[model samples]
Target: MASGDAGVLRQVQALFGVGTVVGMTDAELLGRFLTRHGDAAEVAFEAIVRRHGPMVLRVCRDVLGDPHAAEDACQATFLVLARKAGGIGGRERLGNWLYGVAYRTALKARAGAARRRRHEQKAAEMVPEAQAKERNRHDFAPVLHEEIGRLPERFRAPVVLCHLEGLSYAAAAGHLRVTEGTVRGRLARARVLLRDRLGRRGVAPAAGLGALASSRNALAVPAPLIEGTVRAAMQIVTGRVAPAGAVSAAVATLTQEVLRAMTMMRLKGITTGLLFIGGLVSGAGWLTHHALADRPEGQQEGQKAVPAVEVPDRDEGDRRVILGTWTTEIVIPRAVDGEPQPPLRLEETWVITGDRIVTAQDEEALKVGAVHESVYRYTLDPDVTPKAIDLTEPGWGTFPGIYELDGDQLRISYGVGERPTEFTHDDQRGPFLKTLKRVSPDPRPVTPLFATAPGGSWAIHPDDPGGATDKLTSTIGGVVLLTEDSPDGSLQVTLAHPVDPGAGPRPEYRAVAFDEDRRRYLLEPTLGGTGGSARGGVRVSLQRFRMDPEVLPEEEIAYLGVEIVTPGALLMEADRAFERAEAAGVEVLPPPRVGEPFEFALTTMDGEVVRSEDLRGKVVLIDCWASWCSPCMAKMPGLKALHERHDGGFEIVGVCFDKDAEKAKEAIESLGMTWPQVLVPDDEEVRRLWSEGSMIDGLPRLLVLDRRGVLRVDCAPEEVEEQVVRLLGEPGQPKP
Candidate 1:
């Protein structure tokens, strides 16, 4: 804890009946806080952050890719756990539990982020200036470490824990709730793929395979990579790099390179020359021949082009294959006639350049990110005989084969692949050394259905909302599906359309889990047919409308979400039970829904007393806030100002939704808040209230009550103020 807080804590502990708090450990102070405040844990937790927040934040940020999200998640996770001083199982295990909480919270944040990305898409790259400034921060080692973050969450999770997180194969397995074998297989496959991809980029494995054996030790992404990356990241105002149209970009770069290599000498003199033209044709053939040699599944999903590693690089894939080190080996195909492949330049370079944009909300700052870049180059011998070279690995799914040979065409094939264990070895005719071509047999067929609030069709007018079945419906089937309909799904809007022109004209797709044992799908616009609302996964991004638009004749969009799974409402009771909790000095999230007629309730840590409900008809505003919530904190001054401005028409009952209630309460007081504050309680009743009632998972919410004690407004502080002013009702309305 900060030295400053130690002094203040001593003062609070010295208060009547309470022994000196100055010398207490964080755990002890926390115990006293729960024992004293009950629901006021929010206030105390906030105070705790003011004391030792930096350490917590540093750990969270380093573990999670996003600092802002990490901070918010840390605060929210703590809020639910605040009152459980004794329940933390014990102080010694605190760090472990905290790590578990951090991990889970980060995962949820990542899931939620799939939605936010729409509003904040960025190209993450640095400008020259930022790159220069960060040079000192990056670490570059002879043996660089890499992790497969882009793989499915399942694969990514295990690999990250074992590699980046530095957990033993067994220990990592334990944490992931998987068996050690599963971990080994996953790591083996992941490492193998990483090597291939690195080779494609013309980068040699950073270390020999033998290194993995020696390191029976898990992994730590070379510190240099981390420092260098972040250092490069920090220097720029913005680092977003937008991608060029995929089909166009991938084909043009890959095909053009082959053409140049083949025709460089012939075309050196003239663009209009006949010799030059002939060379171009030959080069195009070579390009097609080489690209087709490493065909991934027919179609590309999120396929991208990467730069080859540096030209003067000394690393070679052949050298490290035996050592078990993960390395990139760009293996060109030799002709069946036993001839060496033609000359090729395997490139491995980090492409650094991106778009720039000021922060949308606060223009003074910048927010930038990008569509990460990776490149793979290939070559073939002169015989035109096809030789096999493995480009993809087992388990790793495939993206569409994007090909563009010497500008004749940019072809994007359908996405296809079986699980790694399910392999299909086939021999195809020679692809001319000229250009790549993909022939998708036919778009897969599917059947799609529509869902509404009433579980039927399209709403035509979604603004007219009431429930899920309040819309119209239809279905589609057996049509060519096309590209994904949405980039980042916030509203599940894409689910309303065919996954692509290839999946099927109809709308039937898969979902992660079942809701009422129903088929998940979408509706499409076929001629004049009405479309349907949809449902599907965000990450996997599959779409199959249950009610295919072609088959349904009509359809509507549907949004299915949860309100509260539990029967008894928590907010309804938070205020009715507040009085006693408040008197004991516990802060609580305000519930404006059930106003002055009732009070919120809470139990102390030791259950010595029930506090929240007994406070009084206090027009209590249980402020559910966090130290890391900018929006929540941003609205604080207005609340304080309103409290002071009105001179106490209502009592400001501050309740922190944080882990360390004592700390939160201290922060509350430090802010000059004269109101009584409470925090999370160790009592089971209070825990049930938060976990079951109100059904909240976020912060900075305000609950207000009317003088007559009716639930009024439950919103942000600013929103609450608006409601409060309106509730005052022009100062002339009759009161109950």
Candidate 2:
């Protein structure tokens, strides 16, 4: 008992005279206690615990599989009740609410335990024989409880009420507030699930479940447990002292877990609601910040900014300064083959007209068979850190990006399919960064500023994004050329490195051009080239040009990205490309139709080649996923259950799109996924299958195929089991 008030404690003791609580309804006792103030509240709280603690502890014990842990979880449950006692509303059955809370609390503890012992889980997988030896020592009750706890929430509740607590069907129904028939039906279904799960673990269910449900050998709740829990819960609830001991720590952990779960659920709800609202108010800039709060830069609010990116420039609200040509001076790192390499310069010109941004490369760009450019109508949200920039290219797609412009220095980064939250070069296929020095006076030379020009180099600025100064130069010709010098002078390289025609087409490189009519320096069309490998990693750049700026040394940074082609010319190029694709008979498939089979073959994580055709005789669930996808991970348990239930008739093919093979393999092993997992090494192919073939825009995509290899459903993750079961029960074999 708490040592506070003697009078209130004595009164509470009199109210609960020796076993007096036995006949009082839980709500009545709880109401009596809640009505009291101060010290009396603590006494009444203890009375509530004494009445309900055993049952809550029992449920926790069943769920958590350890008595000590159960007591701790039990304390945590009452602590929740104590905190929310005023809201008990006097209508709910205290037992039922506590039961649910206890179950969830215990479940949370189990998840924590699982996370802490994840390494042990890996060991269990690697040494299964040792696991078998360990499980052999435990009786069936523990195993039975483990299986029961793993049951879906709907089924598990009835099983706990009707079987463990020995509630009659009507009583269980009353507690669960369901029809008696519903209670009975759920218990029957629960039994079947439990039996199946236990059978897989090599435990004979008939004997174990019978013993588990009966009161023959139930563990007694410890005598001091109720009072200890009440005292601990009261101390926690009142906040008079800090929680102490293993039990106190457990209470803290469980409370934190429950609160964290509630917080996340609420956050998701808020995010979803905000997203819906964002749809209605498309121009609401705050929505973008909130929506991206879960992403990278938004996640790192108030932290030190990454070295690769600068803080957003408050001046970017006026897009006029961003209108001109910006060129990149790059320092290519030494090759993996240990060959010394010189800096490389690339340039991009963005000509802003109203809301539209026309993108062009320098005139010295390496061009191959065709000239290409793009026009994007853009929007900028300047309020957020690493301000959000969205660009929509007509007939292509929207490119989301972030930008930070510091005076003449401009850094803009963009991703292909998704907006980049950070300026990073880690994901080559994902996002790319371009830093430009704004050039003025149309730096494209009508007359070379070099006067009497040789290929002599100009010095790169010390503050350049490329991080090298002595290496950059541009040589003037009828066509301007940018070059970098090796430190040893072993090689002097120009931006026009030769590319083999046999290889795939190269992305455009920066070049310079003179505008005769404007008589100002102008940004050039990119020089297209044949194949060299795409620079898979970060490249720093410096540019040598035909003209030195009229200003002194620091003014070299003033070169701007200028418009290279007219909108009419860009439209012509897009039309030509479209015509070429049309001529090739390109037929882009939409997301695949349900009940239509498509052929695919890929290498499994185990290095075995597997094809859809090879798995014709079984029901196949093709799970297209990536490790980073939460929805995909969330579906694993259901898929695993389905795989287990229909082991002989069904097969699950996990098409993992993870770029990191180790993480993908570890997920498979940790999830204990026995299904054959296909690892798609090529990210582009994985994305194509997801976006074009599967037609599913998100991860955790599931495709069901009948026995004859015909796809039965192109379903969401939640629909996987239902579709799989329906397909398995279908009458005829599908055509291969």
Candidate 3:
């Protein structure tokens, strides 16, 4: 051992007494190490090292000939054990588990070393004859370890305990909680299996493989190595040292690779079983018959069928005239059971290609979000009366409609779940009409600028109220900006207040267009309340424009301002004041601290009022979501599953930021969101909660509250269930 390792060994021995946990089992030692803190935990972990360190080192050394690399792999094996102690199954057979981990870690280290060597040397270089022979002599060690690790648990446990650890059959049986005869039989069968596997790889094994076991048992593990491993593992688990800092980078990388491989193995097994079950369900004869019955008329069995409404000869002139990019803002009239409901303002875009017309609304855009891109396709029939069109979505069936194109303007009228006859907006229940303006003669490619735009809190400065020639020093409220690339080559910019949500007027801008020559970004503001609805007919304009500096400094600040339109509207012109705000850099508010009281009172869809105080006895999960946020909708199933698992002990309150209450209600019912929901923009209390907490920065934001109504965790959608489970296990009394 090295001098540094010797010194560490002496220090660890003096600090922790190995005799304190002399008689503990592997499971007992792991339990103590996980549950205890400080000296007690170190002592427990040290004992585990002393017991299994020799076997693990032997396995690593056999796989990797280099002594230093073997030691690194051994330490990484123990590190993985420390990190995954709680989730490890079959704890009693921990030696077997460690054997597998050690073998895999050694393999990873060997591959990495080989890669480094190849990179450092020239391609023409080759190993000498003597060196190649020596390498070939030891090639069976890795193969031997691989076969042993692949054995089923019933056979592997005895082999690992007896042959690898140098335990007698009786001792191995005792450790496995089985009879000695069973251990002897399993070991005999394991050796026969190993010999056959080795023979297939062109390496004949010695009879019984007893010589191999004796050699491994004779190789003594250095005390300093064990001591150093234990110290590093303790520091890592206690958060005193990160895994990478505690060990060499190669070892850390090897450890992570092994862990990822193990997780993938488990997932693969689960996926295979699910696939088998799915195959069984899909193979049912009656299901196939039912599927065939739904095929289009005049379609023969196993023959492809074209769409029933497909035109034989396409109208080249009509298709060419409509092939470009177009955009529109329209109000969708909505009602439920003949009751007049609030209308939904929708911003839509269409990109018509030679064969298909791609249409996307604000809601459909939200469904794809940033992680995915989807387009709704439509087949146009310019030959029919009023120019028929049929829109088709993947999950939704086709809807028949009519369209008319005149110069740079286009109009379309369509209905959901039915076909429309005429182009009119008078019948609220029959057809929805929209008028769109052409943005480009040819389909324009989505600019990379939107994909690379800076996001976060940006300081805002309106035009100087004093009407001074120079820029103003004072500022109004700041805007928290988030930008995403839409599939139709447009930028979706979401604007909100970074601090004091209710202090200023919140404007919603759904899509943005950039002008290259003038170095200006045009934002078309959707006229609506902050809750996502417009009461009157929709209007489109170049409402907001930003002048970006030609060369941005290191801080990445850009000047933004809105052109003066309606005086009392959300946006106004301020060219000079906007330049001042850009020089000030970005301003981000401090996030709300944990354990802060998150108080709110809002009415649910059932007309029953719910308050934070009333939910004091149960763990509460406040889900801030909107119907137009696709990522939020994707998270609903997991939230519903969490609610079902802890129904009585936990509660979820959804703060819906949808403009239309009826639409929110429809989404809630469709997604089986049985939890109480409060619609925003209509409720002042919910709006105050959003503004005060500064939680409008993103969608699908989850705030977990303890039984005492104190915020315990503020997390994303994926982390909600884990935090909820942990908080549910804690005890807290209701606040008086």
Candidate 4:
């Protein structure tokens, strides 16, 4: 080794404490890197870099033909690996995965370099004759890389382990969990495939191909490149690097590009597969129809259809029956070990389409406005005594269950770790049961229940339980209730206080259930408790009032002590001033649109006022987030990075929808959110801003306003940085 390489190796060994991670597998190292924090994670990640850096560097150098560019591409590949460590499949063959990543990153870097060279006037003159000739000699390197990448994984993995990484057949076999003979056979087959592919690309000499592969095996990656890559990976993982140099910025850019590309490719594959399956299903239906029509009447009546189509085997029949929208109310027994507790009942909607199931619960939907869906791919086995079902979610493993189908009504009993033999439920142990009723024969997407409910203003009167009335008394007043549709499809119900009109009615309740058939709406008052049960544990239910005007005059209706009120009827009585004040105070704003100005002035946690007018000259990102939003909290780091990246050119104004300001503040502090935040519940202007500006479909919504104060993009948190960058590139309006 060179003296510089030796010195750098010593430095890395000392800094990373590499001895502790010795003999660890790639998966073990990756697990430690992801699950552990601080020094422990750094050590594991550094060990990974030390183990695989040379091969990655070799791939980068062969593609880019520039040492500096190669180093950047190598670092970016590791960064991608770091970001995707948890989602990566086939951990034992990590080297093969890294080889593919390295090849792709290098190719991207090479294309970028070519673009830059085209823009540079002295680009051709910059390279010396010797270096030019050397680059030409390795012209076939890219073709070899492409062909190797194109090889089927099983064939490619052994070649990557044995030829590129220089592992023995036995070691490769052990890593792959296959026999040595199998590894040898795969490698031999891989070599023939590569040779044939390279020849088609006009590289005919077998000797030259062998020399290129051997050269890749012999190339030594500099220790400093390994150290830089390890340090960059560690910094990027912790979100500590703010692109201090061009290379650092390039690494971040390249990593995001590759990750985005990979995501798009995966989505494309899924879409194509789904389309193919749909075509197959359509074709099968057509063929089945023709086959049935072509048969004679007697044959059709007496002959049994083939098992594949009309007489679909047990599993397929079950699948056909289960495909559609189903509704269920799951009640978890509250008694734990004979101790009495409130039984929790959840209204869940499951939409089963093709082989996938999407479940949405009403409790979460009412709280967040957007229904959080849990998706799983399911398979049914009807041959069992009690029909069996297994649900599989990516990264979550499989959940086994047993099902019973009785026409429109279906019952499923599932367990976390084991398959239940019978449909039974136990409070403390064993299977949990859910009885579902098919709502629609055709599969339909589950939407928030409140989105489909009626909204307007009504006057409510308390029904006297004692059934006593005093006609002489005249001081009893009625309550005005206003129901509005929130941007996210939740019903926001506000009750105006009987005595206090200036204080403004707060959003204290949400419509939980709306029975269209019964024409009844169940309003659950949120009193800082689960299920929003009212005080003294009494749940309130409202029914539409149906009374004749002859018996009770419309004017005298407000005076009646009846509990029900007509939907969408405004009270016209002596308390007109109070009614008008309440309506004006809690008026719902229209949904915000692109190119429209979003105006708001609200106080921050530190008692400072922030207004849209004050932020006119800069690009603004309004993050509609809450403390309870897990997805919002997950995005804080990226938001912080964007804040740091733009310096003073961009600004983020947080519109926190959290009911408790302290919790929101605590989350901001813990997550290092240094932007100006406006608490929605604390300030009226901020509340209006949230209702109008946000798409309101979900928490963690992001709204971007350009320098001209025009609303540019209203998107999810993941798309914030891209939108902000796009806006920042535009010219700002002149200061008034």
Candidate 5:
């Protein structure tokens, strides 16, 4: 490709002006640059650097915070690209791809910097940059950045490519190897979550955050940094580089995985030939195994291989044990539309062999046609406390669960992501648990029931007859119902909760049923709610619908009644469940309460200790807020107004929840908040108190206190002034 480029360069120069590179596509320019190694190569490389330098700098700056570090990271990023230029295909969106590499590079740099600071005995800090104008700007930027970093890699990669790098949706999708629609949906969901979180913190979503996230705020790369990067790139091309001390600082920072991804992107023409050869060489047996390998799926790669556990030799007694079908109850303690929901009795039938365990819905599940069955190849370690069991499913990966076996009853619990260490079912710490009792003899074969059963309108009844089931609405087959094949070779049924099409997808009840398990058609249905603010704030009803197929024929019923799990109910129940689990010594959030003694020592942004006891005998207004909270920032003017209005009688103390202390300090100084504010410490106790306590689920919360050091009123940002006035007027011991 680079054999004869001097003549081509001269011809291209004659055809187009120096500035006419703008008219040429990235692919065309890249092609020219690849073929020409002398002056033409330099010009093409310069143009590419100039075009993408600002974006690369912006990403590094956002992640690294320090300007010096950002510049170094930026140069290193471009250098890596230059070294891999031959591998980067002409059709690839080099700019977006560089953004991803920059992100990982910046992260690695930050981690290294943190380790250095930790290891250094003496503080090497110098100028504090107190007067830096840029430091004081973008108060919410830190919060936005932290949240973006916390996003799952799948979503984060797209966001970084599209928003930070300014790539179009299609371009971003291509770079990430996903469909454009998938990119759009993920971005939409991510934005909703960000908006909801920001709103909860009292920050308005429109506070230039959306604009700043895009490339519109790209910071220019300094002349020296660009020059240094170009020099480094040239050196790298000539193979004149040495490894630095740490592994992170090595010249070739790109991992083999990243190199493979780059190769895939560029290997368009020869992909088929390469794949055929690569496949044959790698082995057809390995390919066949991987073809059936379960998909590693999660919000992140939460799926991990469970170590192969060797079980004891099977005996007659062991084979007979846990062989029959069983049933259990599942209850999701959530609140729908501010109302608590009743416990749901969910049943499941288990069929166990020497080394296999299969679960399906009982005969009662047939009322709702679709049910999901799960089959697992399990190895049980009976000797351990809370007997450990490793289950491997064909296409869904493996999970580690705990089980307790008795003569006739068995209890099992499993979690979604990690292995369950305990056998509890709390919302936070506990995994989903099932308690099953073996039936005396297997019932009739359920396969015949599926064939002979009359199909029509059928009512769905909960096992718990006493619970309220009025709000649920069920239908046989329509927009409301969907059925698919379960992983366990049973029918998977999903009964949708009645929802306004405008609100988007909410929660629905799912059931798994086996056509025939042993002698009975196993069916088990569970009821729960699953909507959140992501679907907007529209609240729906949570009512359980009665379904009794035994009493009335399926044709007799005009419509079926199924439980509708509302979002509000789900959220409420989740809190209650978490609290319950925590009380049982589970590692859940610690719930804080109002009217409790307000005691604690906090260091102000200026590094001064301010204890609650020290502020005794004064009318204190404790402000809980964060920089990312748009509403919190909006209320700042009003807070400042209040502080100025009643400085003598009232004392305002701000508690900032910003993860970055520098960002919090800057926001406070920029807003001109004279009141003493303390950055909230990231301790477990503090985190739990804030998360579980109703006093701080959302930000911009104001707590008013009397001079006697007793809690007065817990009010919203808008109502703080009125509440303070009332507290000030009270006849409690006046400030001495």
Candidate 6:
């Protein structure tokens, strides 16, 4: 996983000492990696991830036989080593040490699993059945994490590093600080325990082992897991993760929706019936709009100037109706500056498609190249203006348009026409947004079968037996089987995915369900009679009123809890950090306000303590910076600029929460930061804070504090400088 995301590579490059190229041999690379990103041993350690991710993952799969589980262990194993990259003696021994860490992590994971099983057993006895089902769903993945924890430290570590991670026997053994022979024996034992787990869960040797083994290389589809990827992704999601396999199932459902859409696009064949409905969009218009000068032909001399045309509002929610489909020709004009540019005249190729209006998701969004079957579920947003939309129909994608209500007929331009772009949901779904204009009655629409009833409800209809059910459920003989709840109801659906080790894997299904009308249905999940997570398949959205759509949707972000590590530890371990802020003697106000979870200010300045739990509505920045971090110290002026400009909306608090506090203190003192700073304790509190409060993947991370002590950001860091300056506008009237 780390190997494919390019994150580790990016981090390594970013952390590399100036002038160091990545072409060095493993030894030279590790050495430089350690020297440069040493404190950030995690970055350096990724070298190991790149070097051994495949093998380590392979080893874990071989041992546990559950690819996903193996990956979990693999991630955990690397996390442990990252914290101790320094302990790795020489280049040659790196492999050995990695294996050792993997072994230990595996054992710990197994032990944790045992503890969870015990806990689950006790809870099952006490909880009611319905509640229990929900609890089971919620507890599955964590239980898996815990079971991995339960394995004896020694055996578990090697098993994960070797089998799940695909490390060679010798490499895993070296990393675990054990003999290769020991690794082999422990792997054998792990298999035994795994088989026992399978037997307890009523899975066959092939089914159980194959189920886990399939998830080993989740990021990229290795040649072998391709078929398994399709089926396993489908099965794991619905079976153990959800109910019916999720990934493939969801994708398939999406595909079916697309297919249905395409079918609709072709049905409403173009006819003069389309033009009769003037507002309706005809196919691509072959005609060109000749710009006529104000002076009529031969009326010589500039007779008069043309008045500016007023653009209509897009947020009014009015839409133009399509008359029919047309293929209008768009001729690009000659460029005055250089090469010929694509013509500004856009064309809307519409066809009276089947039962639904098929549209393009603006093939021009990216490079105006060949379209990549883009599709979207079109919907109208009563809250805000919507932007470009894609049709869920496979071939028919929606084009961006400026639509206006012109009496009964809707008039519109297909491309950026005459209006500005509308608002879109950018954070969650990829960038391209979708909003529908209530265009003149769609020139081409078929009788609807799934139209929402009054009050936004999909009335349940009889299940069509022969009608291919795109919503997949579990089936027997599947290499992997899972069941997930449908968002529409509590009804359980089963999914069975068979694995063909020859094919690689991809997330083609979704083991997710969510209630559309409201968050009504309670759901649960179970795998092998135990519970776990189906990753992000189940996205629970709250009722509209649960959050302020205007402010929060744009400003709120659920703290990711530092996803860098596994249940990732050490990732948040802010042992020691330094921050150079404001002029040395800048007046520092009270600490920035912090929300719950990271309640404590974690004061360590003897007696004079600052804890987040103790402050509210105060502005501050809890800087988890490093002394060696030039960027950390360099951002001082900006932090100062923000502090000085803002009346008291916020303050900046530098929490030298680095692994080495002494060094940080030296820098802070030398820099003469007049503002108050806290030294984090070296106890469980620090670890807890790392794990819970801040998502400290790197230094110079600025968390802007509002009066409510919440973090808000409108864009990425590089692009938000102006926003930050605005957020810290000229000093305002101070709040008493």
Instruction: Residues 1-736, candidate 2: write the lDDT tens digits.
Output: 5533543555567566533444555566677666755555555666677655666776677666666777778877877776666664323356545665666687777777777887664542454885564344334645666566555344555676666656688876665555676666667766776776689788888865765566323455554565566666566556734367625666777776675664554464445334433332332122111110010121121222112122233444545556554556533343211223553443545444446544444433321101123445578877788788887644234668899888888777876657788887532143657677777513221111111101111211111111011122221111123332121211122343323333332222233222212122322222233343423321222333323323211112222111222222333333333444345543222234455675566667787867878888788877888879988888788888888888888888787878898999889888989988877555554344334333444567777778877767877777777887787777875533
Worst 10 residues of 4 by lDDT: 465-474
Model 6: per-residue lDDT, tens digit, 1-736? 5433454355556555444344444455456545753223334444445665665554444444445655666654544343344444445445444544444344444444565678764452576897665444333333332334334333345555654555688866555445676567666755665565546555454554553454345343242222223233223223433234423343333323333432333242222122212111121111001001011112212222212222323433422233333233333353311224556543433332222333322323111211111112233322345332323222122334433333443333333222226433221111222223333333432212111111111112111110111121111111121222122212233322222222232111112222221121212223212123222221111111122212222011110000001111221122111111122222122222233223333444444666553444554455656677777787666656665666455556676656677786788777666556766556654444443334443555555444444555423334334655554453541232
User: lDDT tens digits, residues 1-736, model 1?
Assistant: 7544654464465443444444444455455545554223323333343333333343334344455555555453443234233455333223333433444444445545665777896877766976553332222111122223223233344444554345587765555445676667556655665565445544555542333233334222222222222222222102222124311332223223322332442242233232322322222221111111111222121222222222332334321111110111122332211224564323211111111000001111100100001112222121222222222211121222222222322111211231111112211211211122212211111111112111011112111111111111111111112211121111122222222223322222221111222222323322223234233311122343322323321112222211110112233234334543455454343444433444455433334433344433334466766665777667777778888877645566665666776666666766777665556665666654554344454676677766555566666655787777776654543342
Which residue pairs of candidate 4 clash? 488-696
Per-candidate TM equals: 0.25, 0.32, 0.37, 0.37, 0.34, 0.25
Better of 2 and 6 by TM-score: 2
Residues 1-736 of candidate 5 have per-residue lDDT tens digits of: 3323543464367446443465555566667666766555656666677777888788778677788887777777777676676665323456645665666566666766776888878754555676354454445555565555444333455666677767788876665455676677667756765675567666678753554565556787766555556555655555545234312343245333333444443453144334432332322211211111111111111222222223335564434565555656543344222235564444665656556554545444532323334446677777777777776654334557888878788887865446688777643233657788877433212121121111111223221111111111223212133332222222234454333445354433322221111111213443445453213333333322222333331112222222222333333333554555456543332223356555555668788977768877777888889999999999999989988888887888888889888899889889999988877666756565445433355777777777766676777787988888777787856574
Q: Model 1 off-target regions past 4 Å?
A: 1-598, 603-618, 682-689, 730-736
Tens-place lDDT per residue, model 4, 457-528, is 111221111111111111111222333222222333443222122223211222223221212233434332
Root-mean-square deviation (CA) per prediction: 30.3, 30.0, 27.1, 31.6, 28.0, 26.7
Instruction: Give the TM-score comparing model 1 with the true structure, all chains together.
Output: 0.25
Point out the worst 10-residue segment of candidate 1 by lDDT.
Answer: 363-372
Alpha-carbon shift of residue 58 in model 3 (angstroms): 1.5
lDDT of each: 0.35, 0.52, 0.58, 0.59, 0.53, 0.37
What lDDT score is found at residue 344 in candidate 6?
53
Ranking by lDDT: 4, 3, 5, 2, 6, 1
lDDT of 3 by residue, 1-736 (tens): 7766765565477356533676788989988898988767878887788788888887887788777888889888998888878876657778877887788788878877887898885566688998775466457777777767655355677888888887888788777776676677667756766786678677768622643565346355677667667778888788844555567787677777877766665564445334432322222111111010121223232233222223334567677787777888755564322235787665666666655554444432221111111234577788888898776533224556798999999888866545678887533233557688999876643211111111111112111111110111111112223332222322334443221232243233222222222132445443323332222321222222222223321012222322211111211122222323334431111134476776666667688888988998789998878889999999999999989999888999987878788889889999999888876666554343344234354677788888887889889887888888888887655522
